[model samples]
Target: MTTIEQASGAEPRGGGVEHVDVLVVGAGVSGIDAAYHLRERFPERSFAVLDAQEDRGGTWWTHRYPGVRSDSDLFTYGYRFKPWTGPSIAAGEEILAYLDEVIAENGLAGYIRYQHRVTAARWSSGDHRWTVEVTRGDTGEQLRLTTDFLWMCQGYYNHARPYQPRWEGMDRFAGVVVHPQRWPVDLDYSGKRVVVIGSGSTASTLIPAIAEKAAHVTMLQRSPSYYFAPPTTHELAVTLRQLDIPEEWTHEILRRQYISQYHWLARMSFEAPDELHTFLIESMRPLLPEGFDVEKHFTPRYRPWQQRIAIVPDGDLFAAVREGRVSIVTDTIAEFTEKGIRVGSGEEIPADVVVTATGFNLSLLGDVAFTVDGEPVDFPQRVTWRGVMIAGVPNMAYMFGYFRHSWTLRVDLVSDLVCRLLETMQAKGAATVVPTLRPEDDGMQLRPWSDPENFNAGYVLRSQHILFKQGDREPWTHMLEHEQEREILPNADLDDGSLVYR
Candidate 1:
């Protein structure tokens, strides 16, 4: 963590105000990565990280719902600069703790201002800077700040809006209704009948955790989701490291495990759908009830990876079902009744508590309003430059994680690349840099990274397009292949026709 010095001028000058080399919004995994790299590249320039929340860890801290855990393994989710020192697959608290450690270790606390929410940002072509308006959450005060470069790290989930499906008689229901994103901390479910709606990772994880105390737990799925179970710890890697294999070699082997799984899933999604379904069923057979039908509870109408798949921590969800502590109901939710919910299949299930884990509304680019020289820029109408920068937007970038691989995999690469780009620009005394897609490059028609229809709440659904776009050639096409990213992203031709410099 480097020391901070105040800019020479603090007051606003005409439309342009206090100027910084870069202004980063949101202090989550992406924002932190961006700031760290920016400092490494240009330590002389001024940069700041602003977050709406009072603390860091963006979504991890925002979401306090019970049974929260990462679907991806922690080994790959952590930043490259910092190694995650915990079990392979970590719980929500563990990940949050890691973020805290990174912030403290880097001494980024002084560089970040919490409770400052950016309302809008407009680029001035004449001045070659952005005038940003921010609202102070504590005092409802407004302040103006300007920067030459704007990096949007705020992710897609709407922090305020919880996705609760409209049921005809929801208001009349007697039981407490909650959304997983806004689970009340003081609420207790001891000896109560709880029904978790939706079949994604959240509900799957919630069922098993809640079943321990809840009298009966039921997972109501409007549609089935593919579920798979794998050990949280890798036995082979553990054995190899114990046998005196180098730790780096062990790490590489563990990373390869993730790559293999990612490729298998991609192939299943693009080529062999039936085989994928069969493989999942076969893997889950040992954990299912003696006479339960796999098709009824696990088979989804959509193709593999069409929607995000739910992963259990070593078959905990299936074990809970097998023990009769948790049950699954594959039926349409008809309406809310006085005591519970009524399904379209004409069954009324009684519950003391109901949790709606339906999904999230995608809010791209942190839902921040942007304008260029007082003219607003329509984001969706613009082309994505390498899936990171937007065409026609200068000195601006957005951090999007890998869709098919771990979130940190691409994030780390993007951070490194950004640092190098800054370094190159500074060396040449360039004021602004932006990447643009060639109009003749028909990359938009290429296969999308993930299924467009696959829906999940928060960051998962928002940045799905990143997967198919070429981050680099060959093995680096996927985020997990960091060696390729190290080679291509940091040292790539900065003067390429795609990037504009001034």
Candidate 2:
């Protein structure tokens, strides 16, 4: 990681006071999208995008482990406004380049200030503004900026640190141990016996890529996760390229088709878990050796869509197993051994290097402390307004993409909502726009954001209490389905009694 170089002149004219129409926190994908959408309507609105990271790409910049790529295809994950002209499944560097192009082309580079981590935000009812405190990473100096609106686009995961489990005998391991999140650029795993601990997408990607050079790679999983091999190239996109259709229209059509199929398959899995289960198993039978029990290594105990299926471009993982480069060990790690790891099955997986591709640490609103009118904001006590804004949080909207579908899908809708809300407020001559719950809304049933039935991701469950709840019904609950959110968030009346415009 590069050191954050502090820019000269911290304060503005010997004072920390500077005002803008909006102050955007975190210049990740969501923040970039928010800036683009806001620029579309309110180009004149003075806003700044602050990022804690030293560079442009947020998660993409953070995780540089070998074969780090999108969990979903880029076509869907890429912003709705900006079509991903790259491969369907793009690598981290490719995605980072895409972000760079978006920022450069749209003139967003100047507006973004890196190494400025937002610490606290206090909203004042009298001023109708947020006084946000940001700490410069290089210098210990703290700075303040006041803005009419606060857009939290920092994403939902904790990037400051990776979630490392406290395993027995971790300190005794002689060989190089690394988490995929903090992969050392100079570290070498060439011809080394490597064991990757986890079966999620990170482990899936790392094993195959490392197996090319490593003498052997073993993906050690507690159980199993559903695996799918999507074609590296979008066939529809390829076909459209041969024709005279504009890239924008072609991209839009393909995006819609992919999203539609996802919704259909997700519904089908719930309707007939048995049928889906059989189909998933049958699909991978040919990929393995004849009579190989794919059910053991590839089949997940839970139904589909419970957790996202681990995807690899063009069956890379399956091919690796078939070619005898990588192996899957579905057993719990008893403990980390000095030599390697000992499994619950009394199996000793000796390795020279161990990579823990465990999942991320969940955090809310970039884990920044928030207050309104001197009262602390408890997210769990508040219901979401279209799954974007917390009810009663004035002039504030945080972007949390769809867990079921590509995150960009929901972000697009929420960005549209933010632009429209701001436009409506300006038109109505309103200073404050808070999602004020109606008397009837007070009686609604609420559920945890990390509910197992709704979202079964492990990290989400860990930070459930820190997250905002969803009601049993609309505007309050997040319609995890993209089509549902697209229809609801964009079309909902801005003047509805839910939002108090004062």
Candidate 3:
């Protein structure tokens, strides 16, 4: 067998080895979800969790920028097992609290090793197990663990440093520059002119919030993003809670409605582009002033949901714009000037602070390296089997959420699949389960896994060629809708010849 390593930092092997039936690599929502199912499914098997961060709430814990909250409803984003007892759109702190509640309620805290960052994993055919290496964040010490199954719940991005483009004369600009990813708690933007770059969720949410305190806030966008202000609390969700209805039933009903509307809108965006675009523009009409240039400022050049539909809670962003505290400049940024940025129109926007809300750099499995029998596992060379597991990779799977829908919706289903997969392996006396492609599959047509034309987010477009591709059929297509995932994950035949057990 060949042995390779992408993990580093050597230390004395001072402790005895410990083995487990499963090693879940994360402590966030996905990791906690996986652990709960594993414990319930295999009561006798040993299991543990590892997380790189010191706290729970993966992205929720890291992104503490002003006005940072969920873009979707809490009912669907929250766990199905536990109902969210808070607002429909919750802040980062609230989500973290909910995560803590879940961990405490399930007694999963004792099983998680926080600050333990996993760097590499290898599958050994001879041993039928994986050797994993983790580096401690507090100390530089390295620890190794062996597991029969490896579940990757560590999300899909580099949160430590977000994408920062080099702006010309940025160093010479006499102003504070900050990315929304690393927001300083003590930052005082009051009475200062603020220019926020990008029209994505971060900028959309930040403009109104900072405008409340700043002298003026301008959302500088190269192109417009589709946005709509959904209610902060769904009237039905609130009514049901007040009427003493079981949240489970109410939430399930809400889930179906939300999913249907989302799917329908997405279908309309592709099927009838002009109609959908016109409808969306009309929807934004009441939010702005009567004579506002809604077409030029709010109307996007592309169809809705192609990237993402940014949501503002309760029309707060629009209110700020109407109040004249917030403004929008639709133009390309030429470069950074001494005071602010110069636009392609030859006009300069002066600001005391320039916030770059540009977005993240997509990195899979925390940028960890993997291998099987000593050969490096190049992900771009692989195809995403069922959108969760990979071909030729045994006893391993990563929970990459749906791009078109809420991440938790798909991850919840994936966690269930992992539990089901583990149970099926045990019942059949199997040591390893790997998805195998059929001989006929060799001739099937395929496309780039995440085509920019299909899912055109900046981070996604930049890294689509590096991700796993898929064929044109089921199990290979990996549909992104939540309804499709919920329907297919449970009832699908486990021994359907594509997933092989040995």
> Lowest summed lDDT over 10 consecutive residues: which window, candidate 3?
2-11
TM-score of each: 0.88, 0.95, 0.95
lDDT of all predictions:
0.75, 0.83, 0.83
Off by over 4 Å in 3: 1-15
RMSD value for candidate 3: 3.8
TM-score of 1: 0.88
lDDT of 3 at 475: 73
| Per-residue alpha-carbon lDDT of candidate 1 for residues 386-417, written as tens digits (9 for 90 to 100) | 55676677888778786556777788777776
**Candidate that beats the other on TM-score, 1 or 3, i.e. the better one:** 3
Hey, what RMSD does candidate 1 come out at? 4.5
lDDT of 2 at 220: 90
Stretches of candidate 2 exceeding 4 Å from the true structure: 1-16
lDDT, candidate 3, 60-133, per-residue tens: 87888898898887787888888787778888888889888988898777778888898999899999999888
Model 2, span 83-189: residue lDDT tens: 77877888999999999999988888877888899899999999888988888876766878878899999987787678888788888988989999889999899
